[model samples]
Target: MGQDYKEIAIKLFKQGKFDLAKISFNIAFNETPSDELLAFIELCDMAKDSPSDALTLFEIYFDPANDDSAQSINEIIDIMQSSVQQSTMEIESQNAITYADFKNLLNQNDFRTLFESILFSTRIIITHKDELFELVNFLVDHGFLDIGLKYLEGSAKMFMGDERMELMLEKIRGKDENSLK
Candidate 1:
């Protein structure tokens, strides 16, 4: 987007028109991902006290090979660890789930980022097979797609497209686990 829109977005954020600022950012993002704009969005979300979403933004900004990705991941670690909601290893429903914020790990340096991500957040027990399936599938598609699928197709495999699985997929789809893609 042009500087005009970005200017407007800044104005909106400054004026506390957070939702509008988000819309403006959306316009910029749809046109092209801007690391700078991503930073602004992070600031905006932080201004709004929604660091959870900020966590998503870093996933897009970071590319492992870049010299800054690891630093960014460390920043993420500080942010997530600081959040009161996620400080402890427990969140009630899966909704409270802190996604595996691993884009920085995807950066080649943090080979075990995913594992660390999973370990850091809450992982609900697999009770009702339906919710269990959805969680598993989410882990597959976002956290560990190949492994998740393998688990699905393997001995512990449950049929995909089960009504339960589909709902979870829908919810997960709406969540931009990774800000970039």
Candidate 2:
């Protein structure tokens, strides 16, 4: 019976019906209590809240020994990426804040509070390198040195060995040091 539920969950998950998949996975987990099913449950929850983080969890759960796992992983990636694209489009349409308005907000004296509010409330997905650079610069210029540095450092992992990223890291570090004086 647990195996039946697990099978159903996997099918639903592959179909990108994550909410239904989660319910099925939860049922399977209650019946079988297996680590794999638990992981899948967690993955489904992460997928609901954060698809990007779900991809990381999916990679961790991937079985390199299984020949079919690679295909499954790719399929999951495609599904999650499409989901993220849809979400990004929705959020952009809803917010529709221009770069100039964003910068204006950042330049305000209460920008720290506003910035933190926006950062926590929004799922900013930078699709372009220039936008990423510009965002980091804005953060730095507005005294959000720590956040800007963290952003640049996180980006460095995705864009390894990119000279621009390296330069940004160095620039942020210099600013950080000078600010400490």
| Cα RMSDs, all models | 15.9, 14.3
Best by lDDT: 2
Question: At residue 102, what lDDT does model 2 achieve?
Answer: 64
Clashing pairs for predicted structure model 2, backbone only: none
Report how far off residue 70 is in candidate 2 (Å). 27
**Could you estimate the TM-score for every candidate?**
0.31, 0.42
Tens digits of lDDT, candidate 2, 1-181: 9999998987787666788999999999898896567667767865654556775656554557657754565565566568667866776777545455666776774766777777765645555556778888778878888888888877676666568887777778888889889
Displacement of the residue 177 alpha carbon in candidate 1, Å: 46
**Global Cα lDDT for candidate 2:** 0.72
- Per-model clash counts, in order, read 2, 0
**Candidate 1 global TM-score:** 0.31
* Model 1 spans with C-alpha error above 4 angstroms: 50-181
